[model samples]
Target: MKNTIVVAGATGNLGHSICTELIKAGTHVKAIVRDSSDPLKVDALKKIGVEIIEVTQFKEKELTPICQGASCVVSAVTGLHDVIVNAQLELLHAAIAAGVPRFIPSDFSSEFTNIPEGENRNFDLRKEFGQHLEKSSIKATTIFNGCFADILRYNTPLFNVKGQTVAYYDDKAYWKIDFTTMDDTAAFTAKAALDATTPRYLRIASFRVSPNDLVALSEQYKDKRFKLVDMGSMEGFSAYNKIQRAQDSAGEDELYPKWQQAQYLYSMFLVHHEALDNDRYLDLMWSKVEDNI
Candidate 1:
């Protein structure tokens, strides 16, 4: 297949999932890993029929040859400016230099493009990279899969497993919040990587679950009556997040600080993944809110 897909950051959770799905689909995946990457992880990839290339630096010249003959490059690297904007930019350049026709950045998050900039720090880094991608010669596809469905089990303020509460703010009780599983996102991205007709943006969610529905589903699954915890207005939550950011300035060096997590919560309620392209790949089965609970 001539390295149909080259995946950077292929050892991470979402990255590994993407590679697994691609290999399952019988596509050749060239996984880019760091020289310091764990041997166990590298061995796992090799066992799965992936070509793992370990590199010391993420330079364009060094990666171009690794990306050569690949139809597309999908980056699953996650982090702040240094990793998100810097590493992905190098990958983008390498893809272009390698004559790869398509690329997908590590934008697997909520509908940040629709949301205003600076609202979320992580999304801000992605927005920064979007500028570079806009002028690139290679074709780009940004997949917004909302929040990972795995968070549903984490018992966040949204779905508190310990408290048995489905939390919400303002009139968002009925608002459908998007949640896509990692495997589901991977399956779709794998399909997209091979499809030449994929557009520049794709929004997908395994479950556009509502607060009320979540509560009901939890109760049905756990056999316990779950409470609806109304946290107050969305504007009030935003204000609280601002206060948190101001108080947690020490977390500026941290990747996901307390305030940053609050920002993610705000984003969950702010925008939605609309015009979903989930139906584009019919063979993939999406995880449901019930299954997650």
Candidate 2:
């Protein structure tokens, strides 16, 4: 019998990509999604042979049997309070009850273990989920792939292509940041889900680069000089922290707070660099900054 894998948030960017990769690897995929998800996205997954199970809510009693017979459960749900804290936790319990051996939570960012709490809101939510998972009986695997390379490629504020500018939290160019394209992250995640030997925590980077390196790559690819903006380390972090505080007060329903948190997260990556696990998966093909540019 073939290996069966159940995926949550299957219509999402990273989740959809993971489903595609799993299908390519010949694994049986069961995509658990909300009934109100985009019909077009659902059709796309169905066209590719994915088994879709629509649920109104993520209750453990309803989810456990959906997870039955699956070897692993991969969640790519993106959110802070309700989805990550409540929904994903419910999914973990259901997976455990159904006897799934591995549970991969939606941790596709930098190593939050080293970053102090409250520095980044998104990382903080993931950190909380990590703590919850640690206390559970099911084995877990986390994939840390730094920032999304493809998002930065088109997002000019982060990696300004038209303006030829790169923003940094500090004046000096001493920090090294890791980046992985969504496609690469998804492919690696699919492989990790199927591999029973995968460790509890895994890290991978398509390219590890500094601010100067980013400017060089932009100049080389665009054939022009790129300007660097020093936003000041302490000042940037303080501003982002203020935004986080506002978010905490405003509750999770507001979009602007989450958007502000995203800005802070990109800025935090410049000042805080953590250990990477890029070399662990030798068979995976990583993307390069120049290639993305």
Candidate 3:
């Protein structure tokens, strides 16, 4: 029987690619978006033959019907940690109620297990969500894709290769982190969802290359000399903890509620030198994109 997969936040880059990969693989895709009233996103999805469902909110009761006959569920929803936790919980309940067998949560970040629960607020919420999943009958897997490599194209400080400034690492010359493209992440996720056996956590990355190497690549490709400047690690573990402590003191209703929490989630690769690759299953899925680059 062909799998019927319902994707929450299907209009997103990751979610859309996942749907496309599944559709190409002969799976039925039901794309769930917030507002079907938005013609552009909905029209684009409809053009691809994806069945669309409009959801005003993400409550468990509301979403139950959205995922009614799905064999699996994938969420790419991004927002505050609390909002994510609540929506995931609601989805879990809805999935279980709808008899959906598998769920892939919105966890395309770092290794949450390496970071302590209380130490980083955002991860603590994820840990709680994981615990909830464990207690449920439905199978769940979380993908940690390190950092999105294509995000570097934006020239942001986080993945800086802009002009003469690389931000966040103490030694720009020595910093090494794992990165995976969104296309790779989507492909792996689609393959994983199709398989009957799935693990709890999957870390997907094409390679772990240093910023210096990246700058060298840019210089080589662009044919221009580029200087690498260390931004002094202002977004590392210590700074993350400081911000967490400040948020705690100020109360949860502050303007930037979970910005530091999100920071802690992003900084795990920097602090902990653990990069994992599970080849037993991921290798087969990776073959499709192995020759793309």
Which candidate achieves the best TM-score against the true structure?
1
Show where candidate 3 strays beyond 4 Å. 117-124, 167-172, 231-237, 240-293
Once superposed on the true structure, which residue ranges of model 1 sit more than 4 Å away at CA?
1-3
TM-score on alpha carbons, each prediction: 0.97, 0.91, 0.80
lDDT, candidate 1, residue 274?
61
lDDT tens digits by residue: candidate 1, 122-234: 89999999999999999999999999998887778888889888888898899899999998999899999989999999999998988898878877898987899889988
**Superposed Cα deviation of residue 146, candidate 1 (Å):** 1.0
By lDDT, rank the candidates, best first: 1, 2, 3
How many backbone clashes does every candidate have? 0, 0, 0
* Cα error of candidate 2 at position 124, Å: 1.5
Name the lDDT value of residue 235 in candidate 1: 80
Q: Is candidate 1 or 3 superior in TM-score? A: 1
User: Which stretches of candidate 2 lie above 4 Å from their native place?
Assistant: 154-157, 243-252, 255-263, 266-275
Query: Of the candidates numbered 2 and 3, which has the greater lDDT value?
Result: 2
- Per-residue CA lDDT of candidate 3, range 1-293, in tens? 87789888778778888888888888988887776446787787777878888888778888888787787899876655555678888888999999898999888876767775455555666777778888999988888887666655655554444464444456546566666778878888888888768778777676666656656665665566456656555346456656667757654444245555446434633443364654745354442212211
Alpha carbon RMSD to native, model 2: 2.4
Q: Cα RMSD to native, each candidate?
A: 1.2, 2.4, 4.3
